[model samples]
Target chain A: MKIVLSATGPGFEAAVDERFGRCPYFLYIDSETLEIEATDNPGEKASGGAGIVAAQAVADKDVKAVLTGHIGPNAHEVLSKAGIKMFTDVTGKVREAVESFKSGNLKESTGPTVAGHFGKGPRV
Target chain B: MIISIASGKGGTGKTLVATSLALSLSENHRVQLLDCDVEEPNAHIFLKPIFDKRETASIPVPVVDEEKCTHCGECSRVCVYNALAVLKTAVMTFPELCHGCGACAYLCPEKAINEELRGIGVIEIGRSGSVDFVHGVLNVGEAMAPPVIRQVKKHIFSDGISIIDASPGTSCPVIEAVKGSDYCLLVTDPTPFGLNDLALAVEAVRSLQIPCGVIINRSDVNDSQIEAYCDRENIPMLMKIPLDIEIAKLYSRGIPLVLGISEWKDRFIDLFEDICACVKQEAI
Candidate 1:
């Protein structure tokens, strides 16, 4: 089974061994199968329509599933259209999330929970 | 006349230069300061403008009636921004990602989708003694800023000199703020990172075909890489702010350096005059 993991956001960065800081997308692979493909979500990087670029990269990989913390509605629509399954709210390390997926514990996400904004609230 | 102060990287004193220049200019001429950094606005903290008027900034987003939505995914098909999604049980609208382009509402065949205003921010017009200040504060978790920036520009005084404090980076937000200005002051430091990003900002402003100058901050800390770049590119180095610990501490406390050192006021006034001279020469 080919799996795509979104490795940014809270509770997932520590599990992922790779660190390409600025790129919005990341790819994780199955060690035994050696199947590899992934993309960064560019939309989260400093605004603009960078999400479309990120979506095109994911579509090119033709991955089967996405595991990550949060998936916005914009990226969600694109991934769905490409027939890619999305799994959200995967906590702890990247390895653990992948393990949960392999064990059939992970479930598909309904959609983005709190829209597209990232980070905390106002200072005052 | 209009002058835009911009930095290619964040925390590089774009607002500092803008506010000080506006204050110095206000003594002799009417000056309006427009803070176009909607995401993390700090000018209001410094200016403390007594807001005379306030208006909500909004943009149209597609709103769907769940009862009428058939989960057919038609609205999601034509959305370039990916703002609409049709799942198993519901059709969702992501307001943050929505650009308010009205494409989804226009393409909906069921007539269930309607355009509605989404509160993204607020535009405030205020006065601080002689200087007029206008800025926008983007609501928390709001992704859109261009519309709010457009609102800021609407308050620009046509006849008086105006200084726009633009957002950092060479991105779309920076471009939107700096566009249509008579001149642009690209603020940068003498470090390697500053030089690299300054080159990128120069390319951005040059592409817009605008006359630009450089202001090197923390001039005494690093080597002369930025100065060398400006010399090589023939872009004049308009002014320099030395590496002073006192200035840094003042900045941390949300105070302009010129307010502490009176002599610095004359330097900014001269810089503004130089920018005006450059623009006048360009017109010929």
Candidate 2:
């Protein structure tokens, strides 16, 4: 019933970050009640393997799904192996994305949305 | 003396200057030219050394013994590279992220981790005319390059002049190649990107306390800025090669500058002597 969305800040109104790894915070929201709890993403300051760190952190939290703008191959693999469903390219703020997911408007990702190290490049 | 040719920006003629200097120096002194770029080592294309010795370059990675592992999470917690992940049921190792520092295995309290050598590349040693040649070819899909660069530098001869051909950028690989050299020749153009990266390369070289000089390729393309930089920094402008269609044509044909235009031989020799002077001045 709990799902995680990569977010720029720690609230339902915070914008959903395009980058799954290196996103500042992850908002954990219970799908039914819409109650939210945010935790700092460990991968935000990691020197390397940001994707792996993020995915492992999510897996450890026992999140049932990940909703974000993009996901790299490493994070994709870790999440896939952990049996967590990924719904990427989900735009809008965290609350909107969760609402869309609840309404079955978001599509599930079958594979990685970007190449490895895609999140680490200059944001422009 | 060990002189390394490095350019902060790619295609600014690090290999060109390195091979020319090595070829010219070989005529008068024993010279060893090491292609330390490892990732895209093209000095061999110009030197054409028939490799007589080839050895695999490897680095040690941790191998966890699951039977003895207490799942204490020590190895994974200690890894700075994020190469290891310890789950409740299993411990995973991503060797590609490993820098081979042996920190994980060294810090494992349960003594469940052992080290194993993983081949990352191959080092080739050969001779091109009188110049001793050495280079490393990193394996495909391998992101690690410093290990292979280190392997190439291992072949440096103490009694002769060793010229290391460093890759572009002031990253770890460039530092690995330029470190511990008597003199570093930073090749660049007169453009903005060239000057920007040149400053970074100079900072890296200066941090190591190594004496360095600049070689401006296509010196006619842009001027006052690069020259002003040299003047302001008090770094000598050792050599200058103008932008010429003939030089470009010859380079396209894989011909060295010294070989394409015999007059350039003495120029490179002068460049070598200038480097020697700088090295001696630094020592004094």
Candidate 3:
């Protein structure tokens, strides 16, 4: 199955071998299986919009699922509208998050944890 | 005429100079004081305007309808700001990143996207003694401020003289506030940090082609690098405030130094007259 994993921490990248540096969002594509790989969410930076950008990256990769901790409303809306299912509030290792998704044990988030604007002010 | 008071670096007495000039000018002419520092606005703390009218500042953000969305990804692709996106099974919208340009909605093949008003800040109109005061307050966590600054500028009356307390820094917010002003007062200190940022501000104002004068605050604290910069640039040195702890204390207590010290009122009065003369000469 083509799956997009949205990891909140560096752990998500630790679980995967390939690193999509500086993109905020990572796209993993399985070469042999021809399936979409997992997507990682590089939590919010001090400058804001990291989560939003990460989610957009996932959308750009055409991911099917987002696995992370506490997806905010802004990110959740974008992912859900893109037909991406979110499995949020899952703690522990990034490998576990991917495992839960593979095992069909990860529960879908009803909605984002928080709503409203999230981003840093203009960088002067 | 509209006069903008700006300092490239924060806490350089930009508001102090602006409010003092406005108060002095209000004695003889109809003066409007506009606080354009949307973030961490402190002019209100000093001016203490009695707000007569208040309005919510809003900007457009994209709203998507799931039923109408086909997940074609067209909306996301058309968004130059990356405010919208399409995943394998769904489409996503990031309101914080949206500039509200309505391009995504206009290009949406399914018409699932629509523009909705999002509260970014508030604008207040009030009276501070005889002067009319207008200011913008960007809500906490809102990334956008130039729009709110634009709204505040629209309320400026052309028939009278106005003083805009611009935000610190030579950035977008400062540009929005200083643009279209008849004159800009670049406030600064005598320190190296002050001179560095002042140079940046000079570049910003010069790019806009707005004639500016420099006001050296805490003039006695450091030597005259700011003065030297103005001399080299041929920008007029309008006035200087001596570094006095008493004055600082007065400011910290929310008192305009000109008001706290009756003897210095004439100094501010002269400063306003000088500004008026400069603007009048520029108009010719």
Candidate 4:
């Protein structure tokens, strides 16, 4: 199974970013093999609906789960509807977050972890 | 003439001025008051119009016909809002994310996309005595306000003066209501935040080439910075409504200032005349 982690860079050693919608990068990792594939977050600069767009991008990758610090309501709805479980309030490096997930240390989010416009730019 | 009352910040007395001006002007001419602040319209509280017509405002959202859809992700790729998503076998549409732009339907290669009407808000039309009253109420949690505001602007009366109470902000909704008006009244307080936002609001109105003036609400509460800014910007200081506890108390009770104070009625009438003069001056 593949899992996604919001990251600050394109590597497992990169720190996990707190924002799910406009995070800098998304690290897709193999659950069993621990191999990683990272891609830049495409919704980083969206004017609005960044969360929904980011969730769609992750869904397209066919990830079974996502680990991030916060998930906005719209993204949470889209991901949950796609049957992709979300573990939120995650911290530390991408590798450590994966280990915590393996040991089931992270709590599954039943709803949005943050309010709308949480990932908005300075102007908004 | 269509005049819009706007403010870059909330609680700057846009509705207060708008309602009173409409009331005072109705005595001598045909006046229509449109509350385009769909998110939280408060003009009804003061005007107390007897609404006889309620119309649901809707926008066209794309609906996909799955039978002919190829699931090629064409529609998803074209949607700037990311409202559409393509799974392996089907397309998922998020109606909330859609802006009713019709781009997806237009770009669909399989001819499976069609448009459907989705209600976003409601429009109430009625009369408070001789003055016509109209307002738009956006459904709760609805982010797109421009569509509803546009619907209210469509009801602008051409024969007589139209007074539009725009939502407080310099964003899309305010722009939708204030644009194309004969003049705009930017009501603001005398404070740093008020001045900052007033500048933004002024820029927005000027960009549309609309003549605008300033109304200093609570004018005595602060310094002369607002007046200085107006002079520098070449914007006329049309009026100054001093900070009055009695006025605030009346507003809290849903009474317009012109009705509660009586003297303000004539002042608002004069304000309207000054606006007409400004409009005529701009024409020459």
Output the number of the DockQ-best candidate: 2
Q: Is the docking of candidate 4 incorrect, acceptable, medium or high quality?
A: acceptable
Q: Which of candidates 2 and 4 is the stronger one according to lDDT?
A: 4
Residue range B43-131, candidate 2, lDDT tens digits:
98888998899999999999999999987777867787878777656677888889999998888898899999999999999999999
Residues A5-84 of candidate 1 have per-residue lDDT tens digits of 65553233444422121234566566347454454454445333344435444555656787766665556666777677
What is the C-alpha lDDT profile of model 3 across B204-267, one tens digit per residue?
9999988899999998846567777788989899998889999999998999977898777788
Give the clashing residue pairs of candidate 4, or none: none
For all candidates, the clash counts are 5, 0, 11, 0
Instruction: Please give the range of 10 consecutive residues that has the lowest summed lDDT in model 4 chain B.
Output: B84-93
Candidate 4 fnat reads: 0.35
DockQ, prediction 1: 0.10
Off by over 4 Å in 1: A1-124, B65-74, B86-91, B107-112, B221-223
Model 1: per-residue Cα lDDT over B13-111, one tens digit each: 888899889988889999999999999888877777899899999899988988888777777667767566565455767677788888888877888
Top model by lDDT, which number?
Answer: 4
lDDT of each: 0.76, 0.90, 0.76, 0.91
Output the better candidate (2/3) by lDDT. 2
lDDT score, residue A103, model 3?
74
Candidate 2 error regions (>4 Å): A30-35, A64-70, A80-114, A121-124
Model 2 chain B weakest lDDT span, ten residues long: B84-93
